[model samples]
Target: MGGFATGLARVTTATILASSALPWPQPWHSAGNAQARGSGRPITSGPNFFTAEEFAMVRQLCERIYPQDEEGPGADGLGVPLFIDGQLSTPYGYGARWYMHGPFVAGPPEAGYQLPYAPRQLYRLALERLNAFCLENWQKPFVQLSEEVQVDLLTWLEKDALSLGPVPGNVFFELLRANTLEGVFSDPIHGGNHLMKSWYLTGFPGARADFMDWINQEGAAYPFGPVSIPVLPHKRDEQG
Candidate 1:
């Protein structure tokens, strides 16, 4: 589990770095800021995209992927599901930036994003099929299964043993994993990394304007808590 946690941390860092080049929707940034400010509040609202059942499944799946250990909070604890919900409500989930009109040909792995379904559509379809598969085999939905069984089902999905209609099981798994990592490590303004816990866990100095004082300390641990971008009250209200 230590290795798993370490790998997840590394991937989270990579995702953060990779996302720096991407363009984010203005509404998402605003909404993320609002959500970030209320990080202490429990999520009482329903998901922006997923149904209640689908959201439950996502929560369970993400927890399994990044479970809490001696390290710190897990995916749920870090508000990963909320982050995903926020993302799916944005243009990115609709694949607005992608060239959606296509011949829809089956291409090699090198040909990026060959699927016709957007991220939102893919999750909707895949979760339904995954639940059906779980019921057919285990007489229960994926969310109700034991942790070991859930892990086994995830492995099957990763191996493409389970079919998710038009969306490949492996593709869905990869998407889920990537998004989970993003939620675990993305800036609080983007609605994950609640209280900057991931940054603290990984010893990352998040969004700090200047850290030149500690740059020269070789092999020395920096003694400071991670800082998140502050959300102004007026801006939060404006976004609301």
Candidate 2:
């Protein structure tokens, strides 16, 4: 993931400016300086785990990470932010499945997930710190920054070039970027990849048993189109 940082930096130019169908900028100021609370607030009355401000940030961040292109619709169009919000609303956000013992050591990269904060805590704290940094340095909130400035700030986060107060910038970047990809490529039932646009873009014959015939055709396009599941959420127990 760290090695991919350079590639990420290279690709965010269009991403920073791409807001094909985002639903954030309008609602951001509508809340009128409302700070985020742990109490789950629906983003636009949808099933959400984020406050209005957090949802705004998440939506903007996802769009910047995977903006629309000639290839297809961006994260904003696919509602990747909503997907992330839904995931965070579940037990996964609380890190329920992780071992939360002490004796914590900041060991090597192989040590794996040494942070004390859960996924939910990480996003909340990181966003707070990030907004603070933006206000102090740029005299505005992150969501209000210019497209070029947004790209620069995100690049700084990716490169660990900025001090995000107590929240590690690189860690936050990794989490945000990873979730963006997951929302783009995961099954639509999870609330992203709307219509399986990514599958069509990647030529991935999703869940199709008959795709075996096309395996040998390297250069030829698949004759069949991509298939997607319904918009409903998959059962967590079934996933487990």
Candidate 3:
């Protein structure tokens, strides 16, 4: 959305999201350079909020969403659940400067979020609701529940059966699930994208400085950017 209005300078230009008159990207950026190396630091909240059991549950949920396979690494490998924890610790966790004022109404799918609760609130409420449902129905915490029970809970949320207070279950599901994917794929500068697996899959050359020469060359192998980092903690080699 941000790029669409600016029109990619080479072809033309139009500013999108005039909310800020600043340039399309901030000056601190590596710009279009793919050499950007992620320090892989967490940006959101720390180990707070998540009890050990809750964290294990999150890991399990993420693994279910993107299981490990020969095709590529899974959500756990990318540190998505950890990324979620960090996001909840950030200002975004407090609802920040967003337009939280609302005479709320349920709208079409495209109407987007109308609630005031921030991500931290969402997680807090959702996890409680999930645990309540688990205890009421299964007599155990979510983390201790069987994989099938976990799937059932997630399915209920996806289908809007497990309603949390204030926030809609589907809304929480979408927000949490979408954030999970975004962190899994985002430029590592912000956090997540542990090993650039998303870039590798999409052939995204990543934040390269000089696509000027290579873009549109059609099917050229991405240089693997000299900044490649191991996607997993165990695979990480500062030298390799």
Candidate 4:
């Protein structure tokens, strides 16, 4: 549960640019010239409990995962943390889609998440448990711990060596980490893939009408690798 699934591992140079088997929704347009809906959105920055805490935690964690560098846009630039928050605010995060009905037993490895807890519960317990462990081991809460301590804490949780709770620490880490990558790469319509840094990393072209004219051209490097600018509502029919 902590590591990758068998046969699921495919390390490639391009994650976003690679041909995906994921059934992502089709690209949609942003509302016209409207300012970003900074309001009316449930913040997912920290834990789902308090708005300020969630925001701080997510922002900090995201920056750690994708630090600003000469490479490209960072996680914050891509708005990954915000996307994570948005996702959690939905039924998906609350475990509405999960099989919470009990007679719950620890089943075989293949059974997967047989327990009744959802993301919110799992995180709530995990956070509290991790904080407690931190108080004993490092004398600080998970968020307050220094960067080095954070790594140590993360490592322990990822390894499932942290005896915080039965929340499946390793499984939780992998889930959160994978989703974090999604937020880093998925279409912005889904609210992650902000500046499209993941696309740049993997050399994938995005939603464009055609590559026919450039296909036959040889030798010369294509003028553009494969860029996908936002296709807002006004640009929708332009494809046809």
Pick by TM-score: which candidate is best?
1
lDDT of 3: 0.60
lDDT of 3 by residue, 1-240 (tens): 112111221012112111112222211223443344564753333456577766777777766555545535556776778777777777887779677887878788888777767778778777777777778887887778876666666667779987876767888777767776667666664456665654454444455566567568655544444244334655344213
Q: TM-score rank, highest first? A: 1, 2, 3, 4
lDDT winner: 1
What are the runs in model 4 whose C-alpha is more than 4 Å off? 1-50, 214-222, 225-240
Task: Assess every candidate by TM-score.
Answer: 0.83, 0.75, 0.70, 0.68
lDDT for each residue of candidate 1 in 106-206, tens digit (9 for 90 to 100): 88999888888999999999999999988998999888899888877787888989788888999999999989988987777777877666665665557
State the lDDT at 98 in candidate 4.
79
lDDT of 4 by residue, 8-112 (tens): 212322442465432222221223212322111222333344366545665655655554544455566667777876677789888987788988887887888
Model 1 clashing residue pairs (backbone): none
User: Which stretches of candidate 3 lie above 4 Å from their native place?
Assistant: 1-39, 42-46, 108-110, 216-218, 226-240
Of candidate 1, the 10-residue stretch with the lowest lDDT total is 20-29
